[model samples]
Target: MPMDERTRAEVERAEAALVEHYPRLVRLAYLVLPPSMGRHRKVLTAHGLVQRALPWRAPRRPAGALPAQRGADPGAGYDLVRQRTVELALAYEERQRPAVLLPTVPFVWGLRLFPRAGGADELALDQALSAVPAAVRAALGLWQLEGLDADAARAVLVRAGVADPEAAQRAAGQVDRRTAGTAALLNSGEFDPCTVQARPTDLLRRRQRVRATAVLAAVLVAGTVAVAALPGGPPATGPVPTAAQQALDPARLLRTPHEQWAETSRVDFTAWPPRGRQAGDRQLLARALRVWAAPPPGTRIVAAADTSTRPPAAPPRLLYAGLIDNVMVVVLHDGERLVRYAEPEGATPTLHFARVDAADLTSAGGLVIGRGNGWLRYLIAPWVSDVAVRDLLAPEAPPHGLHLAPDGVTDRIPLPPADGVPCGHWPATQFRSSPRIDDRRSFLVTDLGDLAPVHLTYLPSPGAGGPGEATGTPALHSWARTACTLRSLRGTGVRAVNNWAYAQQDLPEGGGTATWVCNRADTWRGPGRAVVQFLPPATGPADPGKTAGRARGTAACSPFGRHVLGDVHWQAKSGKWYLLAAGSSEVAGIDVTGGVRAGAAAATLAVPAGPQAPVRVAGRLGDGRSLLALRP
Candidate 1:
């Protein structure tokens, strides 16, 4: 057909845009296209879409189209090509199979080409974006690739024929809330199609194909003869299976009603509300279930000790399904264990299973959804009304309010230091539901390298009833100097760690008062571990307290046992040495015999002594039972 002047002019403008901004235009299309389509096809299809965006004949612009974007070709050509590329990419996503509408030049037969593998952030964003709608994905591309805000991005979507631009923009906003620094990742060469790495496909298999052809033909003939010789041919088998099945359907997943959390007597994972932005997304849920049930070969599977990696027999209860830390995560509970299925963008997926056989209200309150860069985020229970983070090592500092999304996931908080490192601030997540400021039920939990965090509590005295939640400033300050000791309990399947401040006494020579606290780590498996530490009076932040004694496989600091006696040699600022011994409140008197002979009617006894003094400390309880000091 003969080209009119206007059509020729439009084509010439588009040609100029392509010539000047070919790489940027192709990258925009590449990001807009679905990542599920192999990178090879995405690279080829992205190039093809950009080329076809330039119409042979003049194209009609849609209504309400915005002017050309800033810092681009400014001739209206770049805008025309960009919108057309996004439209074609969206259309391609809706197609059944991969196809490039126009022939992509420079295509090779045997080699597969793909963009360079990106870092963890890029991979995570890719995986998360794959679960969103095509229009949402397109809006993200415009925002990142074209540097357009919500309004400008929506205008582009509307011009590209999106039915509901407002809804797309809102959905994109939700994604933006969870993901950070996406533009930088999207702009990196990780998504640049023009610059790609290429490798031959199945070289070994291709090389051996001809050599095995004759052998395969002979085997096929023998198998056909053998099948024919069987009695009544091959026995009847079950009907052929189809792609659709009830088990894999997302709608079939067992979901507890939102109200069940408050109405039910149970307070375990079964009562957790169905939370997360993508919870209702059937496609994402289906993919999650499929990957969990039959994870592809090479899929990474991690399981806690004694935890089974078997897939659930039935569709388990959905706890959460959404994008967290740039990755798509789906948490499920099968009444026995909690399973976490994580799919990082542009990378292999992973399955983590942790034993939660009998989770209690405290242990089931929250779970680590994502962790990275020395920070941890939690998917908290719906019943939780308030969230705050406190540094256990700096108990005097006020707790910082933590933000939570509508889905009940808390913002990332600083992680505690690892073992063998100098004592640093240990951050603990504080959760409470009651309205009262001094609610004794408000609990504190710290991550210990497990799916469920370890609960922290304090027992001020034996007469103070059972160990209560650590809420008051006194309890916080007591645990502050000893929280670093919990690092040794990491990955130990510990259910709770309690600090018992049993005795406080004045030091010798009027130095100052000191407190003796015992910490106990109760594991799910039976045995308990205890560490007795002597904390000097508030001096400075540099003091993290000293571990006086430790006992394993004992119930020393527990509610049932409730008796601990420890001694430590201290050096006062006057350069004088003294022996300090303390016992649980139940003790009537403590006697420091041997090297330093001294007796105190109270549970604490301090007497002057020498360094490395061989001291024998013993205590007599109210019931007249003798208690011996624990050895470190």
Candidate 2:
């Protein structure tokens, strides 16, 4: 009854392969597994599936096995283990429960484990993977993580029991095509289950379960008496339940002293002192807490995407509580997020939540306290000495003074035009701090439909050096053509928007110099949007310029991604057309394909072409990094 020599060798080989590539196999399983299964379950299930995949009998060597990764030897045993692991994972997803009745090995009790949280890009990729079918997810992981080609991915899927490998591959390709560079995100820590962080599960629930049996008999005897005394048909609705009574107590709310801003090491929201006419109103504070814990029916709550609305676990620090324009307003900072609650004269209360974690000097400058009746008022920081409103489009004009009451609330200003709509005048709040203030710098900010306004800055052409203040004439002239473009970023939780003029080229026929600018809108989270525009020589009124290319949720124009490449079709005054292309300083060479085949050793390229010739472009940096043009 003992195994033969061949079977024993195969078992040993499979086990060796699994042990050698344990992290890779677990990551593969984690990516393919259904996300609906919580992170804790998925982590244990991935390990369990891989552990059981060791073959007792020799597996048939499949034709055209996928190429190995990270200098792997492409052994038959590794291929067998990978195929079996994928098969089991897909089977686990298809069935409501595990495929086998075995308990998860190395399971933990009363503890939940999850992979390290990643930035916005990783969060976005995880969400995208969750939307597709399990087979498609497997195909994507194989293609990205295992470095498999399309045909290889299809073959792997087919070997893993996919009914329609072609369909699954196509579905995965659709996602890949929609989002460029998403494949690289698979390598992030977000999908690696081997390296995880652990947190205790609901200990309160565990205690309740332990005591339930002892209290069962007493509850049964008391239930009869309580039921006989009850007289209601249906119990009236009450406030939402809270775990800790201290959270709901108004007196327990934390407060920072007015002088704390000067002594604090980190000059952020933590340093802001509580101020308002009703700062000491216990009844009003209690009502705000109650509503925040559990809002009545039909309450409107506007929170940023992916932000949680759960009430704070402990009493939050009070930032502001005031009556602004006949509306009762309360703002709280719970160390990570900023919560603003507003109740109009007779309207239902509305709550706003925005993540302010790791806030800096620029972000801590102001918070939008009240917005109603086509106006918005800001709760400026304590150190801001003077406030002014400037028309970003007309930088040559003088700034108008904005009145700030003793309470630090500025006079209401008109709301900017709706998102995506171009307007002639764009008003930005200009804050001037006293020179004695630490890290003092004058900057401009404008509301973006969130609690915090986004900082605006201008980076002059590469020769002019680093980013400059928006107040300067040169920076103002640079921002003139780019002001209107900021409208498109409305409603997005944008942290800052920087405008950089990366390249300038003189026209071939003495048509003067043209500029190429990259405008990047970075969010509080990591993901950002980038746009490249072509601006011709200015003559009369300011032109908005023509947009050449755009990319969303990319780091093309930020510090992390300091490369921008784009192309445009321009016709000189001589009535001759040319395909002009340029990139940031990093791009060493440029290549054009499709309608024309050409290459440039420098960052700039000019090719004679028809008015509407189809073309594509890509570039390579001096450091051996390759980048595609923003167009495609």
Candidate 3:
């Protein structure tokens, strides 16, 4: 999240004079050393170095280190927590025996402790960050954490210390020269004490990393084992099939080769691009997505696109794309990289489409995923716009059967019909975060206690139109949303109603008041934003085009009901469910047809911010498993 003025002031006050946030930096760096070797001393020593390096007041006696103090708080600015951690790590490396031997575990642990970091599950994510590549990291970090526009973040990074590539090369040469001087005598065989080294640490330090890794691994394993050993393997009430018509998989509809994959990422904000214009920049972004959509396993990219250019130039750099809304848009960057995307347009011209808000685009870590009820329209209009833009914009009409791809692509994988019972009792997992590499692309996500239902509605679109302009709402979308009555937690696993309200509220580092809510079972899949509530009932749809049977009543959601859900969960096509506790927060919500009533639906109860005011847990609302946390 971006730092507000007050917070920024505190961080600036703390960092401007020196480098990082505070003592936490020292603690983080301490983990890189051999644990048995006076960790406290090492941490304190790191603190001493920075203390001497940047004192409350620069000391007259230059060489001596001062005792570190912690009262000062930079009111705010930048990633205060992160800045503090980086300063500590970098400085600690400068003084430690094995400067390059950064144990990844300590870094991850430090991130988890303060301000919390995301995408820490693998090595590439961790490597993508650093204090040196300041520009790239700053621009991309905002892109990843706050989901800010890439161009904007790039500008901010440039304003900081980063400069263009010509300047960068000059700096690199100067660094080499300074290091090669006779005083810098690694080559002289004087056995320099401060040389950068390999990743592996001495046996003692290695042992420490080993210890932490083993502990974390074992803890996770034991937790899994414990769940498996839980009483009676989660009660036997299986999911009863709902007879809603299902959409044909997109693969079945398309005859050509179709493939997609999600890739993780990293950046270096300090690395600026070359001065002047660059090559094929228009294709840079479009191709970037394609690269990640299909990458070799165990490998990761350095930027959203190119990896060859380290320390890319200039902030506020444009992430170019070639196609958008049926028009070929090529971003121009006199000193920065640009982006362009295309869409279809006809006689009416693509100009009729509204420009996407700046907030909609992300450049740092890549596209963040979100979740909400929405429609998958099946439209069938004559081709009107530019074909290139049309294809990119999804202007073609949706064909019969469930699908998201072109006509005739087959994607059918099946489970018991709506007439049959599911293999388990829990509500099927619903998509939580929208479309991101880490989470499922669910059209409807709701918790009915232990059992959650995640339904994917295939909204038909007019053969020719843009995104948000699909044809018809799918059945699943309708089934997930039904009624506005402040009813009691209906099915099972529900305890009581606590508090509820709908507001355009902004929450803590993660959550916020919901943005959209889909109430009608018939509007499940569509072109607009959606906020789905419930899911298809056991009997399924009474009619031909829906999942919920006997659908009736105004659709609504209750903040007053007690919900028992973890942070994230999902149900695959196999009918098997997967759950993650707030692991992935950003996702594209399911598409709903149109606008939801603004603010909270008229309610009798008070709804404060989630996490406070007795917020409901993220869980299965359809299976009666809603959970609410009581703060201590």
Give the number of colliding residue pairs in candidate 3.
173
Which whole-number lDDT from 0 to 100 does residue 427 have in model 1? 90
lDDT of each: 0.78, 0.79, 0.25
Instruction: Summing lDDT over every window of 10 consecutive residues in candidate 1, give the lowest-scoring window.
Output: 238-247
lDDT of 3 by residue, 58-158 (tens): 22323574533433443333344444333333333323333433332222221112112121111122221221243333333334333446455444444
Model 3 alpha-carbon miss at residue 212, Å: 17
Clashing pairs in 1: 123-345, 127-345
**Which should have the higher lDDT, number 2 or number 3?**
2
**What 10-residue stretch in candidate 3 is worst by lDDT?**
380-389
Models 1 onward score TM values of 0.58, 0.63, 0.21
lDDT for predicted candidate 2 compared with the true structure: 0.79
- Top lDDT model: 2
Writing each residue's lDDT as its tens digit, candidate 2 over 391-447 gives 877878888899988899999877776422357778888898656565567888898
TM-score of 1: 0.58
